[model samples]
Target: MELTYLRTFREVAKWGSFTKAAETLGYAQSSITTQIQKLEEAYGAVLLERYGRKMVLTMAGEALLQYANYICRLHDESKEVVAKQSKGTLSIGTIETLASFYLPAYLQAYRKAYPDVNVAIQPGNEPFIIDAVKEGALDIGIILDPPFSDPELDCSILREEPLVIIVSPDHPLAGQGEIGVEDLENESLILTEDGCTYRAMLLKVLKSNQVTFKLSYEFGSLEAIKQCVTYGLGIALLPRIAVTEEVMAGKLAAIPFIHPECKFYTQLICAKKKWKSKAYVGFLELLSGGAREGDSDAGSELSK
Candidate 1:
């Protein structure tokens, strides 16, 4: 009935081998056997059965596994709540675009408001970043839409940025103020990898329009793509926010798609049962307000 026994049982159930579980839990094989034996003795039931050199769970073990997971989750949640009350540091993950364009302002404002709170930011693409959050490696994440859907995670739309087709200044399409999907038929396209949310949206739009273009290059780095486009390697479709500096410098031109301008939503996601730390709460407020200000700026720019 000890929690240590439950932990051992959970590890055994996960690996389905006493030796493997022992290795994973960093315990001697005899110690793992003893813990399981103690657990079975306490419950007055045989929890595992031998089958072809492997241990399979008995009905009692299976039931205990379920409850063990719940108990562990509850324990972690309780610890997190206590840590937040004590003003512990917060870890956040975000994709590269927001990290580059928005995070500095948000972090600046957050630090100004909560100077004593420690904050850590991890940046990666959506898949890697979301996985970190899902594994409890981060308390919250700001990432592009098409969020990882898990019952334990909650996602809220924070901001929507329009997608634009961009070309180098010297490209044939650069002078066009606005272009339609049909115009890209024979063009060479520079694209992000398949994991990118905005790239997936662009693919869907192309497929729906029956448009065909040569995908000349694919990259994970937005900066690389921008540099390639700057050299007139190929045209790229990117989020408007990602190209602001390039456009301003006249190195690239953003041409809106005439129909159904793709809107990419940035979302704030967190574990459903996570305790909101002071640092996390302050950072979220900064992000929300910054997003609103960004939208207002974009609106005013469009009017001009």
Candidate 2:
């Protein structure tokens, strides 16, 4: 019956992993286990059960999660409705690629518009950002994954962030004038970390085209990968915005992906059903007015 128990239950149910839920909530693994146990005791029913390596919600857990989401949404909505310009900070979660390539202008505009308000951002991967938004740790998340429906989240398509294959100008693929997905075969690829949405999309297209997808190196930082590619270490499919300066400097070339599916997106995601504070509403207005798509594509197809 406790809100804390419901929240912990929701977090656990969302991830289907007590360890991951614990990590996200800054609680010990045993604490997550204890919370779930207490929730089950409070409800007098099993809430979760292990399924192979991952945990899954039981029927009772599924029933509890729906109420948990509703209750949490109501709680956040009430809080935001009472919030004023003098109270609270906006916490944002985002991926590094967007944080680097696309977020600065919107952030600056938000600052100017809400001069009295404070904004904090945590840079993370898509899953982490999404989980953080669900857990109420973040007010917004900027991501690159394709759109999908979620009961707990609402997404706004800020822009079509087309990607391009980047290489040193002297590299074999440079200036090839729009290469096919098949051209990536046997290519040495430097990429973002393993869990990146961009990296996943690139690999999926390669696999579907029967190209042998292989990683020559993986860097935690996009800039590191860009530096490597600038010297011809390997090629990468990256957001065109991220590589524009290098490409224009003649240090790199942005080769278009001819395949239709080699595309990416930039979206603004927030907790669904939560009331938007004045600053939050203002920020979304800025995005809605088309400031998020400031980067003109160097070369690539981006529809809608």
What lDDT tens digits, residue by residue, belong to model 1 across residues 1-304?
A: 6788898898888788999999998999999999999999988999998899889999998888898899988988888765654356778888777787756656665666666667787877788777788788988888876433667688877777667889988788888878888899989999988778878877787889899989999997889999999998899988788899889999899988665636567888888777776567666666666666676463343233
TM-score of each: 0.64, 0.67
Q: Write the per-residue lDDT of candidate 2 for residues 159-262, one digit (tens) a residue.
A: 77777889888888886888788899899999898778878888888877788856889998888999998877889888887887887888889988766766
Candidate 1 CA-lDDT value: 0.80
Local distance difference test, candidate 2: 0.81
Worst 10 residues of 2 by lDDT: 295-304
Highest lDDT scorer: 2
Q: In order, what lDDT does every prediction score?
A: 0.80, 0.81
Reference-based TM-score, model 1: 0.64
